[model samples]
Target: MEAPSFLDFIIHVTGLPGYLVFSWFMILVIISLALIVRSSLKLMPEGIQNVAESVVYGIYSFVEDILGKEETPKHFPLLATLAIVIFFYNIVELIPGFIPPTSNLNTTLSMALIVFLYYQFLGFKRHGIKYIKHFMGPVWWLVPLILPIEIIGHFARIVSLSVRLFGNIFGDDLLLAVVFFLAPWLVPLPVMALVLLAASIQAFIFFLLSTLYIADAINEAH
Candidate 1:
């Protein structure tokens, strides 16, 4: 059998290399998950309902604790989104023939850029043109020196967010594969549990940091 060509390889590798395919795949999964969660929420408690309740309540509590309850419900739509999408994508590594989308730079970059745009948009909504003041810093004369630094800092946000997520997910998944191959027994089981924990932590951290970014944008306007 021949190795797949670069185009074919990328079709599956870059998460959304082919927008239609990946978009459809992700949408179907998301909708299914959403529908399932919706139905479960409507019915009596049992089975996955309890699990769903725990997760939903935990996420609400977590967001409220960090961002305040008033902010939590309003802001958590996006925060909850990032957490769910990322956690699922991270766990994709466990499925045969499926790769974790977060492992790819392009996907991670897209996620980073989306979050970047979101915070910027929210800043504008909160501050209008005054949001630009954030880049200008405290004094007008210092604008020349500070403007470039601020620009660099904003751009660096994309790089840092994308790379950190990609590196952690890719490294964790790779290590698990290697361990499983070498031991092929009970040892990898514990490590696999660690992978799940790592997945949750990574998702929480991403959501938390994104919230902080939004909060900072608002704080700066004051």
Candidate 2:
């Protein structure tokens, strides 16, 4: 059997699921870091503050490029928050003795549902009742066929987002566990490097898909 992570050991002692506990721990850590970075911000922007600013600006630029300046300001918060949270959740698995929250289907699904629902809400908000036309086909006669297909396709986004994140993270974690068990030394180093790359890519892909979904929702064109 694979060894229990540090949080898993805590589960044995505390009788709570380690993933749930560690998720809360990670949330607190992210919040604390945000506060510290905010408090230490300077006119010149050095150290952690500078790094944070760079990340935020990079995301902002990406969002603006896709969403345009007017829409970017309105949706940037949700997009930025999703990117940061997902990235942190993904990379947490790289730390020994901790299970990444993203590795859990529950966590990924919850985030996926959030993105799905939020964009749906934005669609209705932006276009009101006319948003139903998005589901309907280009021609009035095709409503029955197109509506179902569009609805199913929209729902599938939730599955796509959640499964992709969970599968990648969980698979990477399992691979690392097996590698460490067999070699327990230098052999795992390269695997760790690959995992790190996968983690970053998965996070960015999630963010990109989310932006596309939101764009589709608010799009004026049918």
Candidate 3:
């Protein structure tokens, strides 16, 4: 018997076939995020609430270092959500028969696009008409030259963020698959441990770069 695809199942029930694995992961992430946030807000922290608070505190502290205390609160939602969801997916990647949604370019690119649009929005919102002025260097004549370079650099961030995340997680997934297929024993153990570490590091790297991007966007001096 052939295995059923998500499209097949969806079309069977709802007559839509465009849904994909990323959609599934997105749903899971939303549900999990809601639950964690709700739990974290409970009157008494315990179990999942405790864990969630610790994670949020760590992310807030990390963001504070880059964006400072005042800016951290403004940007903490995106930064914290990204770190938590990415870390969760990364952890899921370690399980047998599971791969991180972030291992897919679709997911990572979507995330990068969100970060890109969000920071740009914040920049324009905070600076009003002056946001455009940042791209135009201090010298009036240099505006024309600096504008394109700044635009290219901004767009490049989307590509860099997406590719960095997809490459690392996918590479780890691929390596683990190869090792498991070949050895399936003690040899794969250390590799799994390393992949776990990689997952954590990649999540932090994503968060760090995102925080820096937001900081640059909302920086007063530009």
Total clashing pairs for each candidate: 0, 0, 0
Task: Give lDDT tens digits, candidate 1, residues 20-122.
Answer: 3443466578879778977767557777667777877888888787778666777887877888888888876665345677877777788889889988988
What would you estimate as the lDDT of candidate 2? 0.89
Residue lDDT tens for model 3, 62-174? 78988888888888988888887888777666766665678888888999999999999999999998899878877889888999998999999999999999999999888
Best by TM-score: 2
Q: Where is model 2 more than 4 Å wrong at Cα?
A: 1-14
For model 1 the local lDDT of residue 55 reads 77
Clashing pairs in 2: none
* Ranked candidates, highest TM-score first: 2, 3, 1
Q: What's each prediction's TM-score?
A: 0.80, 0.93, 0.83
- Model 3 worst lDDT run, 10 consecutive residues: 1-10
Question: What shift in Å separates residue 10 of candidate 3 from its native position after superposition?
Answer: 7.2
> For residues 50-158, could you state the per-residue lDDT of candidate 2 as single tens digits?
9999999999999999999999999999999989988888888777777898999999999999999999999999999999999997999999899999999999999
